[model samples]
Target chain A: MNPEMLTKWLIRWGGTAAMIAVLTAGAGDGVAQESVAVRAALVTGTLPLDDPNAAAWNNAAPAVFPMSPQVHWPERIQQVTVQDLTVRALHDGTQIAVLLEYADPTEDPDDAAAIEFMVGDKKAHFAHGQPMLLVEGGPVNIWYWKSKDNKGVDLWAKGFGTLRPHEHQDVKAKGEYANGKWRVVFSRSLATDHPDEDAQITPGQFINIAFAVWDGRKDDAGQVIEKGSQKAVSSWWYFRAEPPPDYSGYVYAGVAAVLALGFQFVLIRKLKEGQSA
Target chain B: MGRALIRPIVIMGAMYAFLKFVLPNIPGSAEIPASLIILYLLLTLSGIIIFETLSAESKDAFWGPMQRFLTGENIGGLQPLRYGILVLFPVLVGWQTYNATAPSDSPPAENRVIHPAPPGEYTGLANPVPKTPENIMQGKGFYAAFCSPCHGANFDGKGPAARGYNPPPANFADPTTIAMLQESYLFWRIKKGGVGLPIEGMPWKSAMPRWELELPDEWIWKIIMGEYDGAHQTPRTWE
Candidate 1:
């Protein structure tokens, strides 16, 4: 083929194809941002609170993620034993509940655990050492649990290192250890008066959450080190909440637009030929 | 000479503009960065010009000057122009590519200086182990386990964990890098590590751990030797 004719044909077809792809891919950009998709199960009845073998959780697929050792204090620890964690979530119109389960060879006598939730639209750094509640700007809600105290506390933070317990707790937690595995549940209302302070989790919207777990058994010299400071004492991972059923309409629209452009280009070329003749 | 360059230079410049302005915004297209597009266009066009000049039709253009002047005969007016372009075009494209892509050979800036000169005992310390096949093999094993995680298996600064660090790990493959330092200099750096590196900017930010805490003095020397021999890189010399 003549180089000029070949170049012209290549440009027209290639440009049209490229335009269609970019528009289609750009439309579903938000869907791509979600790292973890926790399906919001349509629970018609009461959620099983105490039952470990609940059927509602059967539909909720587990998202197993690895824990990364804290990077801040490289001198304190070189490696961490707690490597894997599996999480599942379900929602009943009014409340959202998440189940976090992880394996531990030896359950510490302290049996202490903490989970943090950030309630905003902005992307989170989920950095190590500093409290994520502080790294997440506006407000973050934290739930702290200890088996020795037999109590869980709800805390709030607004900046880098500021963490304070709320006068009233907003999170309820129940935990159990069986066969060297720890399963804990955290549940809260869909809507709350302190929307600013509480993470307003709703179906179909994606929000960022950071996880930190401390194994008291791994502590050195009776000093239980966890949270903030990248060491074996603490570990962090970032998970973005995604609702069930993938909806990508932009990709379809992009295909339709490309077809229309191709049709129009042919029509225009025919008209130009007729006028020249 | 100036007149002979006009056509090729203009064509190259236009090709650059086409790649930079028109290519990046094309949807569904491989969106190469503007700088990369320019480099690609220059290299390609220069290659084509050279390839086309080598053909039978352009033979007079390449050898015209020698044939015409020696025979005392005036051939076509195109021979001088073709010879000039054939001689100059490749050098121009090669120089541009080298300038754009090659690593800067200048010494590190003041703020980037991780460690200064050695004080007393570390000045002339040499590697105790001879560069026998066994010792080099052991050094290679140790380096793969430790240094390769951040310094990269190829001794480039692009290891898996090297991404987030502020100042990236040293690339041993760079000729100006480890090739400039002595064995004793490396020994001090390995023993004292980043802690010995004084706080100039953000202190304690050095990702390098003091190997003294992790490995003995013998292994450090072995790692240095293995890197030079294994990667086949030129060692730094007093000369």
Candidate 2:
């Protein structure tokens, strides 16, 4: 065969092999996330404030976020007691409620969980908020719940070791332990009276959120373990109240298609003129 | 002539699929930035266009079908194909534009130097500790206590604390990371941590704790060796 024919054969076989490789490999888009946004499904009537196994929760989608040990600060846990937390959210126009469920074999007195949201426009660091000296916008609104109290406290924090209860305690919570799992519900108003201290939940908008859990265990002597910053925590995730479907995206897509077709017509006219010439 | 017209498109599409999809799925492979992928495709397309149009015969071979299609010439039995192209091309363009312009919650693209130049003083410094088995064992213990929380017990940078970190921890198992850097550079990085990065490493939000304050210099060297052993990688030689 001639050199040109040999080159053609090589190209043909090489192209076929590459096509096969691509097809067999499959299109695996490796964009992995630890947790998806916890969408608060819109519901009518009263929200499930205290019911963990309520039938209404089936309407909301569940998202499980992997929890890590709080190892950044001096008081940190070396071993992770809680591996992950399953979260579901629901909104009743007036109030928003979130259910946090995690697995723990023992129910010590210190078994507690908390959900936090960014208080300002700027995002703070997810782990215990950001240091105030280094940067601004580190304030967070925390809804803290404990099994011992069976209640939730509305708290605020600017950074590590700065957690303080808010003057207006607007958050409420209930907890139930069954089947070796702790299910806690934290509920608050969608629009709080104190926006400065609380993270106002707006429909159709995403808000930065994080979670922390303290798994208390007792020794043979029945002494409660020290559970402070040494707890299982999750990085920043998103919480958004599901909004009604809008048709704006379809309109934008239609306009773009029309513009592209118009450009193609101009290209066809240019090609026709060239052919005539 | 028809084959020539489709060859370049096929090549471009295959390359895009490989870069955007196949590469990331490969174990121990870092993600190729979308901007870098676009740059590569543009360069490949430009080269192909220039080569195809180098001669009159080749130019005719390459553009003849395109010209005919646009001008609606000699499309005799290809009426359905012509209509299909007319509908699909605009829709494809619209879909691509929507994907590019749509709002997403994913973080914005970041451009930062991964391995910046070490300072002159640290460049000549060598590991003070010898690579003994006992020392390595000690280093492994220290790593489990100090580094494993974020760098991971397996040295793959997926430690439990690694979530939500924008840059994440460095995966030593990847050849592009520790295997590519000199031991001195690793020493400086470990000693100074993220706060010690130069201006080129801006937006320095790395959660790496500075070990110089807590660990001895000899222990740091041992930990470096331990990291290499854990990741099954060797430090880059000066030679």
Candidate 3:
């Protein structure tokens, strides 16, 4: 082969290589942004499926629901038990915080059966270990007392991010007891998953919340009678977030494209080498 | 040089063919790869130039293949240009389809309206209808305060907590579902909660309290028939 033919061949190869590099970089950038959006939606968005009220009541009621005293708890008994009811959800978009206050609904409320909203699978304190900062898409559980532990109160709740939370603000939770009845302010904002179900706690969606108290009808031992019964409360709240479009599934599609491009680049280089060989 | 190029190209091409045909490909994945698409565009333009230049040498046959330089026009078929188009079409289709459909999956909207109870013919057990409006009103009030959150106001089974429920609540208004349950079923369900029951989310795990103290036995019947299960008897803060 002459030097002239070799030179022409080398120029064509260099031009193709440069064009391939430019296309790779351009396509790679567009796809990376797309991938982030996809992952966020998959993890965070998919959880809050329906209106918290309907979703909680229709699906979660059997575990924790409200019924006339005429009906008893365990309409559908399962192996798992939910107790010590306390739940919360902060709707940042609306700037409302919601808390589910579980109490005996027998006209007279239960004073002794203090509601404990704890975190972890089994704890009696605050839900999610007294979260220092509210995690947007975190879930928390609760346990309650029915008549000084005559029977126990148990429940589970999952909190999701409806509005992007303000990480800067110190999460200030409060409790109040101004009225004749014991009214503990679980939160300041109606921001739970099922705020509507809570006659008192609104702007939140409801989950596994069991309310129990001394029925007041006691036995001869001077002790509170009956297993402090528990019931589920079905409720909902309205929450909105910025249109999911701004960020979208940019990261996810981006990653897919990136990996695809990287794979293509490597495969093509190998292919070209193999052809030349 | 011919042996060097042909040996590896023929082997790799055969492997590509085999993998493409034999593998259980992921849906939408085995298309014109991006690498192949760019290569196709380049090759097509290059082919036009290469063919035009090669054919110009044999002015009588300007449309013939470039291989005419090494093999007569009757010898080698036009294989290079043919391969380029096959690889290009799929890349275009895939990129376009992904863009068109990705945004369609949006987060669901929130619903706040309460649903009502489902009324249907009882096949199992029947409760005698209450005699007066007072009874109906009592039933309404009882359900409004208690049952409404889960069963919904209209009893169509679209309560607030409906989504997380597996085997979502039976749409009470639907005759198909209502016909399945007897008055006794509602009574039994009302009397005993369904924590561990076969009912959807009520999975034998969580059951509501026995409200025998809050309400009288008869009011249970009223709430069942009156079906104000989805109304807010008390003011909800988040409404």
Candidate 4:
């Protein structure tokens, strides 16, 4: 075949294939719809390691989410104990840090506070266990922080009561209580190769995240200290990671489309004589 | 055969892409900006028009068989079909052009009249705390924590999350918005929230969550004081 004929066939088939690929990849059906949307603002400057008062976090956007009581067996509570949760996240390419601030009537002596955040593949289902909150059949990473402990425990679990401590501790947390409120900061690397940790975060991509708060208040009896009970469990939500500095996905899409059209037009002109074929 | 398949594939594929990838990604729900859809539709329609103009004879090759089947065994039966196509084609083009160029702030059918009335219990209620500079500053902090995500830092209804909500959060700056409503009404709305909205019109679809138990009464009142003072706009009742 001549160069003209070869080019025309290539354009015709190539354009059709390209369009199909773009449509299928972009249409993510199983991804959970955002019940709550959190925007993790991009910060280029360095953040204070292991400290909450980082200058880089000053300009971060704050997201406030409602904390409802965990109404399930062994931990059923009719009334919501906690009121609201305000969160802010900042990333400077190397690390992603989250700051959470919420009001607590009084600080519990035994356990100050705890936070559990789940992040994994978009297709993964977030299951709230009747006895505990955990996903079924694996791939849920839980970061548990307690005020009394020097460091927090990272765990990987699949189902109810299946949680096992992670091989290595990856998440660092700090908690400060003052003026009837607790402010906590959690930080970790943006991406990691750890088997138990699914830390793949990219700009413009949505990831499912939910939070559980544990208030360590005790009842009248000293034996009844709910040392680490989840007082509130939030519904599944999503946060789109800050897009890269050169975020031009739309521009690329536009240019690719225009080139596809130009290629189609050229092929049509060249194959006009073969139209009857 | 190859030429015939290519155009349909491209057209349908492009439409699929627009509906799937483009439409869902556009910021708002009920307030979907028509400009993007309009542009895509116009471009696809123009592509068809260009192709039809170029392949006048071949145009019949695709449409002729279907047209014949639709008007089978009837003399001059295709006249209505041709006339119908001729009339509807321009109407579709004109509608798309209007939507593409129309102002986004234009109210929806249900937004024609959305005046909310406070309940009897809440009618006479007012902020008990005095609005000192410190109180106003504290109110600003509460507003930033709870309301700023949707209502915006300046209460302009252009917050980051505001783009995702329909009937985007009320703009306190607008004369017809909080400026016209009393503090009692604002209090009731914040406490009861979207669920408390009158069951009439599109008000029921509001995404505003009830903050009654979540936010303290002091903070709620403070937010009201802070918003009006910070924005330099007076609340309706204070006048």
Clashing pairs for predicted structure model 4, backbone only: none
DockQ of each: 0.02, 0.21, 0.03, 0.02
Q: Evaluate candidate 1 and give its CAPRI docking class based on DockQ.
A: incorrect
- Per-residue CA lDDT of model 2 for B75-142, tens digit only, reads 78786788889899889988887776655544334477778787787785677888888988888888
True contacts kept of each: 0.00, 0.29, 0.04, 0.00
lDDT of 1 at A277: 64
Where does candidate 1 chain A have its weakest 10-residue lDDT segment? A128-137
Task: Report the C-alpha lDDT of model 2 over A1-277, residue by residue, as the tens digit.
Answer: 9999999999999999999998866765554445657989888867898787788888888988877777655666667678889999999778899999999988877899999898867656565555422235457899999988999999998766888999899999998999899999999888988877899998888887888888888658986553778778776677887765556666777889999999989999998998889
Clash pairs (backbone) in predicted model 2: none
B160-216 in candidate 4: lDDT tens per residue? 545434445788877788778777888888876654555342332345655784878
Note the chain A TM-score of all models in turn: 0.63, 0.77, 0.28, 0.69
lDDT of model number 3:
0.38
Candidate 3 per-residue C-alpha lDDT over A88-202 given as tens digits, one digit per residue, 9 for 90 to 100: 3333343332233344333232333323222323211112122111122233333333332222223344321221222222123332223322222222222344421221222
Ranking by lDDT: 2, 4, 1, 3
Interface RMSD of each: 16.9, 4.9, 11.6, 14.6
* Model 1 lDDT at residue A162: 67
* Model 1 clashing residue pairs (backbone): A18-B27, A18-B28, A19-B27, A70-A230, A71-A230, A129-A228, A129-A229, A134-A159
Could you tell me every candidate's TM-score relative to the true structure?
0.43, 0.66, 0.28, 0.44
Query: Which candidate leads the pack in lDDT?
Result: 2
Candidate 4 residues A159-275, lDDT tens each? 446667877878888877888787778777877788445546666566556566766776767552443333565544566557665524444544555555555456445444344
User: What is the overall TM-score of model 3 with all chains considered together?
Assistant: 0.28
